[model samples]
Target: MTTPLTSTQQAILAYALEHTDGRIEWFPASLKGGARKKVLYSLCRHALIQPSGDNWQITPAGYEAMGRPCPAQKSVPAKPHTRQNSKQAQVIAMLSMPEGTTIPQICIATGWQAHSVRGMLSGVFKKKLGLTIVSVKTDAGDRSYRIA
Candidate 1:
């Protein structure tokens, strides 16, 4: 069941909906400080504005409230995918580098284990950013990635 939101939550949802692009949504810090904790929490809990890697966006309710069709929603919206933590962000940045470093190299640079490195590539980058993994079989081994 959809819980009703207070005016403040609605306001916050409206604002978030107004600004979200595919990659990012900017909230004015001035408006969302400690005083607005409940408002923020409510929007998030109800799946109205989902947390992106470093931003937030309008979920189905938010889209519906704004008189638009909620993209791909059949009923209750799917849970918001969790944002990338700092470690995940570091992995994304490194993988996204022009030189296209390997998993081993990334592990060395970031101090993460091989599993964590692979998780970044498979978990967040592939699912969240919608990127494809690329590799070339060199004489030594497979190396590199590019947005595919």
Candidate 2:
């Protein structure tokens, strides 16, 4: 069996359970710096928690240790998620058009700078969302983007 959990570990795990997202960003105000690191180490050492991005995530072992029922796993949607009224949706809709869209047009539509539009195209659409974006430049010097 793993070492018995400390009260601090229990509290953190309980908080993560209660929140249902399993993200562990909260801590008692008194638990600072080295003390916090020690608690995290203990939780990890016992296989109760795991590092996810910048925060810790309570593991299935954590729920078992806490005597709490585990939350149902969330499923990723088959389609890309986008808020209907968001600027991202607007940009996507514009790109979906057969005529496609230009940087200046997207800038005006989304109220984002040209560079910001380019960054979103590269970072959010291409890299993060794994979208294949087609960029074409016309003889008239107009460059357009579309999702392929």
Best by TM-score: 2
* lDDT tens readout by residue for model 2, 11-54: 88878777747889889889999999999998898888999988
Candidate 1 ranges beyond 4 A from true positions: 1-85
Q: Model 2 lDDT vs. the true structure?
A: 0.87
lDDT of each: 0.66, 0.87
Indicate which candidate wins on lDDT.
2
What are the models' TM-scores?
Answer: 0.38, 0.58
After superposition, the stretches of candidate 2 with alpha carbons farther than 4 Å from their true spots are 80-148
